[model samples]
Target: MKEFLCTDKDFKDIAALVYNACGIVLGEHKREMVYSRLARRVREHRLKNFSEYLAYLNSNKDKEFDAFINAITTNLTSFFREPHHFEFLKHTIVPQLLNSNKVAKRVRVWSAGCSTGEEPYSLAITLADLFPSSWDVKILATDLDSNVLAKAQAGIYTAANVNGLEDKTLKKWFLKSKDGHTYKIKPKLNKNIFFKRLNLLQDWPMQGQFDLILCRNVVIYFDKETKDTLFKRYANALNNSGYLFLGHSESMGKEHSEFKNLGKTMYQKQHNARTV
Candidate 1:
């Protein structure tokens, strides 16, 4: 038996709220997941059922809404979760930047939906390893989940959180805690990254264009229309010839002519492409 009563109406209401708030499509498959997650909130508020919880949520939007959003959103991430993206960054993209940006000596990267800091930290590690300290390099890591943002900013992880990394990487970039159960990222790697809370569906406050943007594994949750609009926004946010890295399972259609696919979910912005 379920802990809370989640009627079809309740599930539909939840789905509509989630989609309207963050552009995430909560399908029928997610009904049980949503129930399980929101049940805790229902219990926390001492509510009798999902119906009561929804009533409370509607009446108290300012306080309960953030909690509601945080509960429904899933955050699954790790350091260097996809290694090929980093390898490409290290070998191909960095070399190109060295040549193309030689005069400016500046590089900016955005890790969209940077869950719990791993992806941005991975990018930071790669850039720190290659770029001269004299060069201007910065990484903007943004996510809608404030909870994950707090953890990311802390830059501390369990020893198991870094299981697959090389010993050299561990030694060079992490400080082992006294109990040896936790590792904290070194300042050198963390310095280049700026973590911020961002909703992809909302207005972006970032001023300057990025040389590379990594929105990997994020767009899969959005509907096609939202995805198309996001791709256009990404195209506009990037510098000419800037690179975009999506999740291995995600790919843009030919309709998104602004980007030329380089395989492996990597794409480069076309210089002459029309803006959407």
Candidate 2:
């Protein structure tokens, strides 16, 4: 990879571009990462420095800008990620929703930052096993990266990616490939879950008072203001007392007063005067 130096002006422009294009506020510490990943683009385009790259990101009619957003965002994911959330969803949430209302028959769970298919597929399996006879469960999975979205929609994974799972869950959720070295989701589990290209910072186009929302391990990249706005939107999108799950390392702190913490990484929307 080619190396380029990012000056203060370069940093400012790059931060603004990332935030505007993807709602990701790149902090000062990630300056080197910007230079490192994007420097290759400069070299590939044979541009001289970060300043030139900034202009290209602004002026290019091509995907130099789109490619930058794609490169800057992280897309790490796994099955049963932050596994306690799944346990909580299965043991606590599903039953509550099941007993509550007739509309509850249609369960809409979202894997909000669903990177690949793993999280939603895991949720689908849990829903299927929970409601074996019902065909009403749905998982709305979304991500910013179209590349990962395509891979996620395909629902194929190398054996190594599925390593840290109980044998039973693996067998139920994935079909062993002909090579016996890879895994793919069976259509039964794939039916209700949907994949869409979404950016959390933008106005949400889908209306959902979803029963459950899983936004794990993605917001750590955003600045505090971005996180605050996104959480507020999430609160609005959820149903009455709808459950929200965040990453194990993340929290819904003083920033938002509408959500009450049930336990680590689990939250419930409180009774708001208008919403209730």
Q: Choose the strongest candidate by lDDT.
A: 1
Provide TM-scores for the models.
0.98, 0.91
Please list the residue runs of candidate 2 whose C-alpha ends up more than 4 Å from where it truly belongs after superposition: 272-276
lDDT (Cα, tens digit) per residue for candidate 1, span 26-68:
9999988898899999999999889999999999999999889
Model 1 compared with the native: what TM-score? Answer: 0.98
User: Model 1, residue 168: what's the lDDT?
Assistant: 96
Error of 1 at 103 (Å): 1.4
The all-Cα superposition gives candidate 1 an RMSD in Å to the true structure of 0.9
Candidates' C-alpha lDDT: 0.93, 0.81
Q: After superposition, how far is residue 51 of candidate 2 from its true place, in Å?
A: 2.5
Q: Global CA lDDT of candidate 2, please? A: 0.81
lDDT of 2 at 270: 76
Q: Residue 82 of candidate 1: its Cα lDDT?
A: 76
Off by over 4 Å in 1: none
